[model samples]
Target: MAQVLEFKLPDLGEGLTEAEIVRWLVNVGDVVAVDQPVVEVETAKAMVDVPCPYAGVVTARFGEEGSELPVGAPLITVAVGADASGGSSEGSGNVLVGYGTSEAPARRRRVRQAQPAARNGRAEPREVPAAPAAPETPAAPEPARPSDGPVPVISPLVRRLARENGLDLRELTGSGPDGLILRADVEYALRAAAAQHRTAAPAPAPVARPVVGGETRTPLKGVRGAVADKLSRSRSEIPDATCWVDADATELMRARTAMNAAGGPKISLLALLARICTAALARFPELNSTVDQEAREVVRFGHVHLGFAAQTERGLVVPVVRDAHARDAESLTAEFARLTESARTGTLTPAELTGGTFTLNNYGVFGVDGSTPIINHPEAAMLGVGRIIPKPWVHEGELAVRQVVQLSLTFDHRVCDGGTAGGFLRYVADCVEQPAVLLRTL
Candidate 1:
């Protein structure tokens, strides 16, 4: 007797409420094996191809491409070994794994320990012990610490940058909402400090603190809207922070130029930087993880899907290069070209935009020296590469011009602290500064 099976939408790691159907790799009546790619779903992160949980014949596709599916909603039906309601017919009927489970009540029994009787007949009401007295209140408030003076609250990315550059956050003014410190503020302060160090004198701390305006509103739609939602959710739900470092992009640029000159497809400087970031994420798997609040778990993936922010006519789209950590520079360059073309033409499928383990955004393309970007929700961190410019540098008692780039890494603080974020950014810089580092690992 042939049986029927129902497949529902699975939890795609980011706790997303709904997902858009990108495409169907398999059609009705097609026999599929367990773990076979059946369909692709697009979440906010990237498009993910879901595999079949059991070998069966596809009976039907419930939804059409481009339709949104709520979690646990059935997407397909199949005929397996037994009837569709084979295993356990509890809440909402049974579906495959990744697809949410049916709601079912479980009965569990617990045994309570017996309590000893009080010595006195005060066994009355179990003779509860008297509560401890409250502590006395202080006469005055405690003094504030030196570090607490006028410190501007900025994004996690700024805080991480400040810490790495040995910046005193209290001395910097904010440019964000309500006097919040901004990534630019931290960068300016760091540059000022670096200049002071070169002059053999410490500059007086900045006293003029800037206050952010009270009523500022930005419409949340398209790319900016998506970025706002992701960043806000990351800051509120994920304990996140940021770190910054300077990368000597002189050699990386040379490599890029050379690669391009030799009949290689022209790739963006950002692509080279992304390749380095992808390599580093492979070495440090923690950076490629997501925090599961409901399960209270940190999930680390074996593969890397490096998501890069692409500004298109539609909005800001992050097209991912799947299995990025395993690919070479040439492969990445080609893939990036394909992704960019698709994004520009608005031909990218929903699946092309989901499933990122880490992200990279090149503010450098805009000639920005340095700025903190918000962390992508669920992903632990995002690496922002600034424009590489030829700046005067002190090299062994001589001042010379060299190409340098700033790297801003914003991470979820709930998972890693300043120190960890710093280490990860530094690792990424090292890989970019010395591409040979990846050669050995790869």
Candidate 2:
């Protein structure tokens, strides 16, 4: 007789309670092997593909694409032979953030080397002498574990990282007790596997990768959904008024080059622009405020949490550099590097990504000349920096080749008018055009 096995959403690493189903890799009745990719899931921070844990024929699918399912909820059912149950168990698979596998009770397979001694050849159960019980008081609820499955003992950030990287949980050998996998184990496995491929002898020539056709519809969830919604709302709801200006960043670039040569964190144009924008906000505090029509308040922040948009495999995520007004050039560079690294590696938390007072989208890295960028919602303004193209400029009626770049500042018309927004942009341009002026504002 074929045994029916239920597969639930595995606790996608960290303590993620739920996740959006991205796409199913296999269909019902498809024969799946152990550790095969089954479905894709999106957590708050990244997109992850989950692997199957049993060899069987899929019988049912519990959730559809874009639907949010709770961790440990039954996602699918499969039919397997009775003899297949005793096979070598690799891990079930890496949990998507807030997602988990089957809700079956944890298998208690303890190889106890030491236990409480038996009395008179009788195995005695260990007991704890409880403190005097409170009078008929109810027991406080315990904190949530991942699910009915084994409680994965890994950090939330590590779980997110593993999910984003498409790592198989079973392939990673857990160092934790009872063979629980850790983040380091997964990372080490990835590195070691990569090294092995590099050292291995050349095999027979492989066929070229297949070309995919047709429009692929990927699910928008987690950070990508949040980013798309906020930007769309800001564009449709907020009357975004923008102004453009060209600034000579020759001096700024020279100063940065000199500073980086002095054995400090190498500052990028975006980092310098971030610092400049923060200083400019000091003079025009109104641009640093948010509008709340429902609350009848214009929330103004005292400190600048400068948010820079970084593109990742999951989606566009902006990790804020907290207190941008306080950090100097070197410190700001360090913070930007740390935030960007965390964002790329899927280690940044929700708090670090949210609560931005202002945003900066740098298109200069892509070598784009200019663009009219949409503002990030709640915040009044977003600045877009264009590429630093070497162009001839008329200086004192004479043609001179100079480094020139455009700046586009988009702001909510309800909160900031053209004059206010223009002044802020000019101030930032002036600061960038002449980096020495930033010292006084800070």
Candidate 3:
């Protein structure tokens, strides 16, 4: 007898809870090898191809393309053993984040392995637990679930989401495979509660609510939704303040032009600025940190992981330059180019998009002069650079047409005072004003 093993949507890391199915790579009865890409899923971070762990025949596929599945929702069922194609029950040991197919890491398989009868295409429903528990002890007030009964939720992320939102998990009805309470169920409950509350409020609520006629409404999901949620959280949680300074970038441009003219690989202004950011962060390590609100402390980082804002067709994504402090101008240039291309092509990974200690936003690329940037939380600060344009400036005690650029730094005040923030921005501006100043640190 062949054993059919089910594959759930593996946790795509970077704290992502769910993913929308972009495309299905295999159909039912298709023979799949271990670690074969079975489905393409678009998480909040990036597009990823989820691989099947078991080498077998795909017996069944769960959820259609364009359906969003929670982290633990079944993606595909593969029949293994002698009768199956490839005839193997062993996994490739290359499962995605938070998923394991081996006998070890018993907690991961507890949701399925405990119930031997539910191994095939059919996963046992929550009622099965309730049914067996109640008939033995019929005198209990609650039969479906007592305080200690299983909650019918497999994904810890779903549990965490409900806990954080002040929503009770037992109260929510599962709409997922085998009556599993997925993240969608919790989200739906929250939305329903919000809608009901809005309706029950005073008559003035009608004035604020959008009228549903002749309006194009889009559900904020995928990348767009992720951006909205992050930006909103940054605004809501961060006590951010912006400070800007106008500096003569004429020298900075001249240095770049000279470097390019005499170089094998052309250097980008962004790399130079990133170098400057790293240097400045070395001096004012306060900005290179994040606020640990629960601990009531500012967690400062030893190394600078510089994040640069890249606007792509997918939306605005900040791809991080890992260990920016150690990389030279050439390395930084190459890394920035690679990350920008990845961002544009929508191939950037979750690791590339997160763990940024600081962000360098070049709104100047969009032809804007200056902006009060929002701090990319839980980051402590962001450096905003505006367009470098020919403007009349006092140079060598004389009025001259020079490349002028505005530098703005938005910081979490909880980390450092305005003096430290001002010093950091001033150091960055100084580097732009005189590129030679950066050479001492270099």
Return the top candidate by TM-score.
Answer: 3
- Candidate 1 C-alpha lDDT tens digits along 1-442: 3434566776654346776675567765566666666876655544456776656556556666656777777666555442321333233433333343444334311211113343321111222222322243212224545653335554333453565466767776687888788777777777776787769866664444334553445545434556678667877886656678887777777777787898856876666777777767766678888889899888888889999988864467888899988877778888999998877655565557778889998877887888878777778888888888888876558987888888898887766668767777888788777767767766
Model 2 RMSD in angstroms: 14.4
Q: What are the lDDT figures for the candidates, one per model?
A: 0.66, 0.70, 0.80
Better of 2 and 3 by lDDT: 3
* Model 2 global lDDT (CA atoms, 0 to 1): 0.70
Per-residue error (Å), model 1, residue 77 = 22
Q: State the TM-score for model 1.
A: 0.52
Residue 99 C-alpha lDDT in model 3? 41
Candidate 1 regions off by >4 Å?
Answer: 1-225
Q: What does candidate 3's lDDT look like per residue over 327-357, in tens digits?
A: 9999999999999988866778888999999
User: Candidate 1: deviation at residue 114, Å?
Assistant: 71
Model 2: per-residue lDDT, tens digit, 1-442? 3445667777655445787776667765566777677886766755566777777556556666657888877666555443323333334544433344443333422111113454432223332332332343223235434432233535434554565566655455579887776767878877886677668955543333234553446566577767777778887777788899998777788888887788855787677888888888998888888988798778888999998888875578888888888887778888888888877666676557778899999978887978888877778898999988778877558988878889999888887678988899999898877888987876
